[model samples]
Target: MIATTSLQRMIGALAALLAAVGSASAHPHVFAEARLDVVLSADHQSVKALRHLWRFDELFSSTVLMQFDKNSDLKLDDAELKDVADTIFSSLAEYDYFQLVTVDGKDVHMNAPSQVMTNFDNDQLIVLFESEPATPIKLAGTIDFGVYDPTFYTAIDFTEDANMAVEGLPSTCTRKVIRPDPDTAIAQNQKTLTDAFFNDPTGTDMSKIFATKLELTCKP
Candidate 1:
């Protein structure tokens, strides 16, 4: 359950903070758009890797690009790019890279990243990385795959269904989107919380109530 707790903790604090503000439009200080590709191993029996593309908001991108551009070249050369890529990827290691995979309701651990790259487009920071599950499992029955920031510090959004794709999977397998909705009772209660509630950081994971999840189901 450590993994589950990690997933819930990512956004729990952020959700409480947002609820205290009492406005939906006030949230998501950091904005990011992402696309994920699920790569399958040869023979199509297990998940081999995950390829990710994350485009950060302009404000954050500016900060990162400025820091990543070494030698004051105003351009990220090969060495500079790799430096930034490794830095970002390494930093995210503590958060499990916000990627979660489960088979039979159990979490799967991902090994160290094999590839990391970065680019800048229209003043936005774009990152690409690839990783594999520590223990690959057979591809059949039900599989749960989702990407989330657990911490609300950065809001990861997939603007369209097409943003996520599966590669090397049989046509019989299908994927679906699972958008989480806040519990009505919990939503109502948040409105009446006292200042003390916000001060006390201990509480349930309200973020999962609003976090989005991606589910992939396969035919047996």
Candidate 2:
């Protein structure tokens, strides 16, 4: 009877040990989705222009800033600015990530609007633009953003020399086990993992992730 009792105790101890170990290796799940809207002007000039407004809401375990800094220190010379602008404009024109198309036989171009301060006096940059002259402009597309959570593993190790004497344990049971719960670890480390993920890849691909809608304007 004593032998059976000892075996049951051992089994229970082993189960507990395994459970503790397993708890330290779990991961969190995450996802994201977004919406966009584009509007065009009524004036149907050959070079018609309209406004493109993008509204994005992130659905995830945490909130992430889309713009890293309002005042970027990366200074650009005129050439550099032109290059950047050209690249951005061309990308918007050709890239599938953006919902961009010619409206009223007029080629649409993305333009930087003047900065404006809100009621709170916070300066904000406009990311959308419309072409000049009243042209028959049509709405282009929308973009969706998404990402998955990254996994992290942490282990606690105790050297044999660090082992303290336990009154009841045999010398063979020398190893000290230490670990943290996976959920707790994930909750603690998710921000760091998310930052790294975004840092590596950068912006969402617009073409495959975007859609479009269009309507006509009655006024000039």
Candidate 3:
């Protein structure tokens, strides 16, 4: 017969092992091609985000929202939300070819629900903050090639050319727009295209046209 204390210890050990296994299983390690579109408020107050609009060969069944902070350690406050918005907007403006224009010569603040939906896959997602009302901001661009494998690492190589039209912002504040050089752009496009051939669901390898471009548009 087994001692009661020994049985209890065995149960606890089993539980711990199960937990570790579950955590490992939760992460999917397969890589797939993806693209993302991120929009930001003119005053750097919030962001309107989108993703996975243009898939080269339809490798994924549905778009899944990979939690930005999978560990749940990073919580968003009012100030943090604004900071995130500013970071995204500024990053796009500096690294990509994007235009920021004032709307009707007014600084408009806006708000929306915490959650937003995608039209292509009907995927429901939550944004950390809402867009302020009366503030209209728009972003348009494209990402060429990227990969997201939950179990491993998410790697993406792409360029975006966006135009941000803001309702109320100072004219003196100018946003910079940057784009990739020809060689890097071509390489990213080719890598993305090649990856699709191997991972696409159809199992038939298809040659992607490196010259093709993807476009994204956001309106709020």
Candidate 4:
């Protein structure tokens, strides 16, 4: 990678973290633990935005640090972390920042991240961002808010250590995590997928079968 500027280095790092899978089928080339905070409108009748936190796996974190640690320091400094966050916020625009949102079976348009923050801890690279809906989604019927890599190059999972929460939700509302089992999802939906689906930069929405989702439902 011939990076002549700091911006180039940051972009290079983002590319490294987003390296595609080479498999004939979609497979994970990178991994991360994820958390989400779903914020509701002040009226509690609509969704405002989804705040995300993703802590990348050790191997990919090291690869990212290698690209951004320009000062020869062993660890990522505050400035380096900020650059990394900026890279993610910009580069991931095409990926919808890995967020998939829907209401009553209708797709919810998500705007680009409004803010980004980064932290490096215990040899991991963590990114935080908030993405707002193009328009507030009314609290009606079922809502599916999820995190997935459309290309399946990165497997973002929600583990017990992390949480998926809804803030300012109406007392009548309920929320649940819809974390799918990969093996089961593959068996059920792999037939609908093709090489083109896995390789396409702007792929179809076939990744929902294996996503870690937050399901929010409100009573009529």
Candidate 5:
């Protein structure tokens, strides 16, 4: 079940906090706008790292600020921000930092980030982290990458195509952000999706239908 996932436990707390503030949603209680940097090695032969930036929705941001603003000064000081970052870093590690990467139809293993950074911008809480592939991801064929909460407890969306970019992709490569239709995704996964999951996806993966990923095609 999703509740069993360590990441979900923290999400549940955030959901409860949002609910208390009257801002909770149906499935994804938390929402964030995401940007991804697909970094490739100097030779463009393998992926170097993935850098992510997530700016949370206002309601959830405020809820988080309230919790982390230990001094109750309506400001997240550096220390407080680090506290927030630490909390999130610990929680997200078990979920692969909410990142999924594939190369030529094979899964790419990613190591846990060394640390996460937090920033408060325009009344929203922002999180930044970078993950390195455990093994070299050669640019042999199709490479896909996306960030999302599989349990659907958090809605992480790339607001625009421009938000996804390749830092060092060679001119020979082609990449695009493919947005999937939620309805279509749900329909295609009908057999796998149970009614209980729709009612409460605390244990099931809901990412296939919701993840907007960057698909890269390269001939090497």
Candidate 6:
């Protein structure tokens, strides 16, 4: 049986010790490369679901894999994979899987992930899951979505343009990555607010200044 509290604490440490950085910067202890697959309904006017893939950094991957490696095989088999998936699903509930989605500038509430799976690739751990909106969302003037750690404790990086994908969209749809520079806001308040800015364990509003945004446009 899994020790629920122990599992939560261990996974929670991902935010405090996954990455090596300077003391001057208290942000981003965990780093992950992620991808987004937006699934549209057959009509091409409604979003049905979102499929996500996240590959964890080496330090974090090694720790998680070791914990889930039953039988000391240094690998996870079917049973082990299910165990890891369950643990992740339970732990991530608190973070909402770090996903933010919007349609026409309005925030969309997502249902809990319907599926979660675990895998190993090139010595790193990968997690995949699919989630849908509370209700299917109709395509409006524009849609915006992203995978992120709102608390800034985890740095989710979408490495390239190809990491963002749209499926079932009409040929007229186009997407773009909008990377904003928040240095000015951070710098202006650094001296007086540095402690509160980086030390907020929950990450609160800090993500607004750093989260990468993906925008989609489709011809009406």
On TM-score, the candidate that comes out on top is: 5
Using Cα atoms with residue i matched to residue i, what is each candidate's TM-score against the true structure?
Answer: 0.73, 0.24, 0.23, 0.82, 0.85, 0.80
For each candidate, C-alpha RMSD in Å? 7.7, 27.8, 16.5, 4.0, 4.6, 4.5
Q: What lDDT tens digits, residue by residue, belong to model 1 across residues 98-170?
A: 7777786777888878767888889887888888888876777777766665545677788887777776777
In order of listing, the candidates' clash counts read 3, 16, 16, 0, 3, 1
Stretches of candidate 5 off by over 4 Å are 1-26, 195-201
Error of 6 at 24 (Å): 12
Candidate 5 overall Cα lDDT vs. reference? 0.78
lDDT of 6: 0.74
Clashes of 6: 1
Off by over 4 Å in 6: 1-25, 184-202
List candidate 1 segments past 4 Å from native: 1-27, 183-209
State the C-alpha lDDT per candidate: 0.67, 0.27, 0.30, 0.75, 0.78, 0.74
**What is the C-alpha lDDT profile of model 6 across 59-165, one tens digit per residue?**
86777767777798888888988887888888778777878887777788999997688888998878899999999977766888887665465677889877888
lDDT digits (tens) for residues 99-155 of candidate 4 = 889888778899987778888889998888888999888887899998877655678
Cα deviation at 52, candidate 6, in Å, is 0.2
Best candidate according to lDDT = 5
Candidate 3 local Cα displacement, residue 7, angstroms: 36
* Minimal lDDT window, size 10, model 3: 146-155
Encode model 3's per-residue lDDT on 1-220: one tens digit a residue.
3233322222111222223435322222222223333354545433333233322212221222112222444434444334333433332222121111123333223332333222222332222222233433443222222112211211222344332122332333333333446576547677765676468522221212212223222233
